[model samples]
Target: MLEQGRLGTRQLTTLTFMMVVGDMMLIYPSVITSYAKQDSWICAFIGVPLGMALMAMILKLCSMHPEKNLVQMARSILGFWPGTFFSCFYLFFFIIGASTHTREVGDFMTTQIFQYTPIRIIILMFVIVIGWGVWHGLETMGRSSELLMPVVIVFIVVLAVCLLPQVDTSNLKPVSDTGVVSISQGILVSIIYPIGEVVPIMMILPYAAKQAHQTRDMLIAAGLGSLILATLVTISLLVLGAFLTQHNIYASFVLSQKISIGSFFERIEAIMASSWMISTYFKAMIYLYAFIVGCAELFKLKQYRMLVLPASILVFGLANLVSPSITFIVITVVPYWVDWDTTLGIILPGCLLLIQWLKSYRKSSVTPNNSQQ
Candidate 1:
């Protein structure tokens, strides 16, 4: 192994939970609403099992390989040069993923809360903190997640519960009005995101203390995360309605403002925002960590910590250059990013798995023939 850090069962579970919720809280409602209209919540409910299926596939693939990560496993299955090419492509995915995630944090900060701050300044601040987290290593990040995840869950639950009274049942009237194709599209969008993005976690899973139960831990976390997003999307549709949720870029945040229990329990959007940022931090930091560690593995470097500074600088630069404004991310990057995640997370691993199975089967048959002869 190129890195030396371990994750407890709790740390792994919490980290997975946070990764699923991450930035989805910011943009998913509008994106899914645009796809399924009023049927968006239905897509959320359907995604739980389907999303876990995808997660289970990834986990099964990882467990079969034991200590090997995506990079090493690919190299072993494919020839060195071919695998290197594939791994290089994955590295590109990780860095770009990190950059775009960083860009989102900057974009969100400027547009919503820190209106006066320059985008680069906001990105730079996050890059510093995120880079600092990656600087420590996976165990450090895992421990931090264990501590912070509870607060995030509480905020998300509170946001949903507090906004229930405002939910208009009629907003969801004419449900299934979008028809099957549109609902499928919406469900696909919901799954490919957050769940698809969980691919990067494979790089760190080798560091987990117990491999036997990672699948269960991941499934539970993913299911919980899926349901939580479902609740948020459902409530967003019911409270803000399909029209408002589709139009509102920050539907979750705006939904937070809708809380009104005697006025004293209102204006707690900050609490919700904090949870989103924390999850985003974990997501982006994990990507960057994978990039750094992947680079170390690629170059045969002794440790990944040395690359942290340069990688952080690269992320900061790319984040600014990736898009001119938040609209580009919402309009252009958001949709395509899902495809990117699916390709890297699902398709690539599935291919590698099939190849491995064939090779094992062939080897088994050859051994029987040789023994009989």
Candidate 2:
């Protein structure tokens, strides 16, 4: 009971990994292929340091106010009205993110594996499981992360091993064919979608165990997770080739399909699919946690658990209504994600850090003189 809402460092690490590797592993192969062609892995490699820097900026901000969530700290620094407005905006972003993720999971499952069944069913089922995780609190979510992450990693390693024979070293030739401009463009897009979008994790930092090394743990988790993602994306490109990887809707899934062992061992897509499902489930749970917490903070509700059901309902409804089809999600939803996530995740948070720096400068300048007086 005492540990109900609290999360240990290892759990937090796993949660961070789960948050990143799921949807990112699913979409990034294709996104990078779209721009960099055979050079797509370059995008991931280029983005990693930039992504780590953005997260470091956020972590520094969190260090400045260790016990406070972004909502509370912003309100304290910006005053009540502006803070409340910012909080509302962030909460809205988190909820819309939940809806978007719900839709994505539904679409992915229905399109790839559950075609005969309605997508609505998939969405509802996902929402229900996610709601349960939300209600149980962040500790349970973190534990789930701990339990599921190893499986995800193992599957990734297995897939990589399987695809080794198929990898065409020629595919990686002339890696700079697109020049710096194209690779840079791919890096920019990849940064915003998967990495910049991690700003929401600031809310969970306060819930992590109160250790002096909390920040260190988080950074390590982020680094290791990014490496895993970068490696997977690189392998996908190498084995599948950029053109085939791009055309394949789920490039990672297709990569698994290519898995072969001698003349007999094959059809490991099911194992890959199961890993994806677990990874995606953890991801949806984190979004659901953010959504529930945001709702509680916004409404000044006493218990976040109470909002879980209504939030799930909201997520389920919007997931279905957000796009006419998966194609629409690709065309419309993704660009909007790239835009809004960049603004909130990168630009706004960076501004907050600047403001805090200025505030510290002004205080230091005046405090010594006032003491002399």
Candidate 3:
């Protein structure tokens, strides 16, 4: 069984919320709106049901083995060889996710703040800091996310509210002009990135305070987070319009630039930058911690700290190698995310659920009396 004092259901829920809105509030609006157009908000809006379904599947798997993390539960349900192999696959995914998030932090900082700084230096700094946070363990990660979440939310809300004067409704005009199929396709594209990314959360579910309400809290967190994401997406659309925002790489940052209150309240991009930085750092730490723990579990290590430094090196190196340019990063990550994540978040969970049902049926057929257990 996983150790006690992992994380409470509420904390896990909070983590989920922060995960969705944190770093994502920076890039998602621009990319999603790029495809979905004036109706891009509609894309995220449609994601509500899909996101809930994904969360439901994940939570059900967690519920099956209340005390086991995804790696452990995979072992129990699939037997030794298959489970071990799949666990390694998950570990790779976690490591890659850590690297990708590190890239995000570096790209944002270098582009917006330190234009001349090398990406390697920025990535290394975060990797070391995140390595330290992960070494502190999950409780510290949870508390830090909880403390940062409110400040992040307030910053976002202020930006959204301030954009009220600049909004242009006509920018969102001609809804569904691209036809139902196009809009639907765009929605599917948009949903794949954010909602499907939740697959990584399965690793953390066993840490939830109460197994009984794991699904409940997962849904709650997914809901609250999606609501926040969709709201911000909508606000971005209303504030900047679809055309201009589609061209701007950091739509949220540009929107932040537009927030000026009668000449006194200007240059608020710094606040948004600060908020996004906190979220980005937290995201990097969370994924790295999961990767470290997963490695420890896989190798049967006594403690996870041993791998933290080496893993940080690997993650920083990979982040540096990811993209030559931000545009290249965008071109690559968009489609790759949709395809791979569909397999991970949607297909993988569905397969697990179906296999569990089949096992239950077979056991019932073999020994109806003892099968009750």
Best by TM-score: 1
Q: Deviation in angstroms for 186 in model 1?
A: 0.8
lDDT of 3 at 232: 78
lDDT of 3 by residue, 9-51 (tens): 6678777876666568788887777777889888888887778
Lowest lDDT sum, 10 consecutive residues, model 3, at 1-10
Expressed as tens digits, the lDDT of each residue in 1-373 for candidate 2 is 1124888888887887777676777777887678778887888787777777777888999888887777877887788789889888788887777788788888888888888999999898989988888888888888878887889999888888888888878878776898888887788876676667677687888777787676777777776667777787789878877788787768888888888788688888888778878877877777777767765765667777778888889888888888889998777776567678788988888888898899999999999999999
Please give the clash total of every predicted structure, in order.
0, 0, 0
lDDT of 1 by residue, 1-373 (tens): 6778899888999989988998898788998899999999999899989999999988888877878877888788887888889899889999998998899888888888899999989999999999999988898999999999989888888887887778789999898999889999899987888688888888888888875666787899999998888888999988989999999988999998778899677888888788889999999999999899989988889888899999999999999999998887778877787678778877998898888889989999999999999
Q: lDDT winner between 1 and 3, please give it.
A: 1
Q: What is the lDDT of residue 90 in candidate 2?
A: 82
In candidate 3, stretches whose alpha carbon ends up further than 4 angstroms from where it belongs are 1-4, 211-214, 369-373
TM-score of each: 0.98, 0.96, 0.94
What TM-score does structure 1 among the candidates reach?
0.98
Which one is best on lDDT? 1
lDDT of each prediction vs. the true structure?
0.88, 0.79, 0.79
